[model samples]
Target: MDFDEYVAARGQALERFAYVLTGDAHRAQDLTQTALLKAYRHWRRVTAAEHPDAYVRRIVTRSYVDWRRRGSSREEPVDVVPDLPEEGASADPAERVAARDELRRALVTLSPKQRAVLVLRDYEGYDDAAIAATLDCAEASVRSHASRGLARLRAVLSEPTVPEELR
Candidate 1:
């Protein structure tokens, strides 16, 4: 497929991948844009690869890691907590949102490589070999990262939820 067609078909997926990797929408957009730009510059080479999407995804993951290493991705603390839905509000959606937010918070606590391994293996459903390829690490390293990442996530998520009144 041509570069433009490939992008049109896969841009949103790439953006979502970036968002999962970075845990920030704005950062995800920037990461995706940067990766796509780089990929565009080598479009012929990328498209010639057996799995072009994998090539682009590797770019996104590497770009995120590099951007974080440069220390330009400072996370600002939220000064105010948003009000939770009122009592008797639709319970399921609220619970799902809270759980998702909790998970996201837990994810951000992981080291970048661990988080990338976890996301690629668990969220993106990639195998260890594929994750190793994406992260440019050994298969054993990918397994190690995923194991540590999951352990950390479980530790974070299992912490007792703070009472609402405590806020």
Candidate 2:
């Protein structure tokens, strides 16, 4: 596919992937835009690859990792937390949002590389080999990062919840 077609097809998916990586919708949008711009700038190089979408995603992931490492000194604290929307009520929206928030917090606890590996492996449903190819790391390293990342997530998620009576 041509660059335009690729962008139209993959933009939303790339946005969601960025959201999962950054855990903030605004930052996710920025990350997606940055990745797309970079891809567009090097469209020839990217489109020549066997899996161009994968290549762009790798760019997004690495860019995020690098930004995190370099921009740590300018971080700002969140002054307020937003409330969850009530759109999906099958499960309590509040609880679901809380769970999502916990997951986001757990994600921050991981190294950027580890977070990227988990997001690609579990959230994006890429296999270890695919992840290794995308991240340009060994498959075993993907496995190790995924393992450690998942253990951290479980630990963060399994902490005390509101009492059953409250729910």
Candidate 3:
């Protein structure tokens, strides 16, 4: 497919990947824009790449890691906080909010490499080899990261919950 067509088709998916990486809508947008702009400049080479989408994702992930290393604030800027209530009436909204906040905090605690590996492997549905190729690491490294990342996530998930049983 042509560059324009490819962009139209994959843009949202790319943005979602960035969002998962940064956990902020605005940062995700910025990361997507920066990655896309860089990709556009090297369109010829990127288009010829085996998986251009993966290539762009790598750029986004790398950019986020670099940005974080520069001592930039990780908190997502928000204009207004949404006050949506919990889904089921059986659950207390406050408890749900607390759980969500815990998850977000846990996600932020992960190293950029660990977060990238977990997001790509578990969230993006990528295989070990695909993640290794995208991250330009050995497959064994991917396996190790994914294993450690998942273990950490599981530990976080198992922590005490506001609703007690929700833990």
Q: lDDT: which candidate is best? A: 1
Q: Candidate 1: worst 10 consecutive residues by lDDT?
A: 76-85
Ranking by TM-score: 1, 2, 3
What are the runs in model 1 whose C-alpha is more than 4 Å off? 76-97, 160-167
lDDT of 3 by residue, 1-167 (tens): 66788789999898988988888888889999999999989998888989888888888878987887787746743222233234573298677877566566667656677888888887888898888877789999988887887777657666443553543
lDDT for model 1 comes to 0.81
lDDT of 3 at 45: 85
After superposing candidate 3, which stretches have Cα over 4 Å from the reference? Answer: 76-105, 159-167
Query: Which ranges in model 2 have alpha carbons more than 4 Å from their true place?
Result: 71-101, 158-167
What RMSD, rounded to one decimal, does every model reach? 4.5, 6.1, 6.6
- lDDT tens digits by residue: candidate 2, 86-125: 4565288677867577456556667777889988877889
Per-model CA lDDT versus the true structure? 0.81, 0.78, 0.77
User: Model 1: how far is 86 from its true place, Å?
Assistant: 21
Q: What is the lDDT of residue 143 in candidate 1?
A: 88
Ranking by lDDT: 1, 2, 3
Superposed by TM-score, candidate 1 places the C-alpha of residue 127 at a distance from the truth, in angstroms, of: 0.1
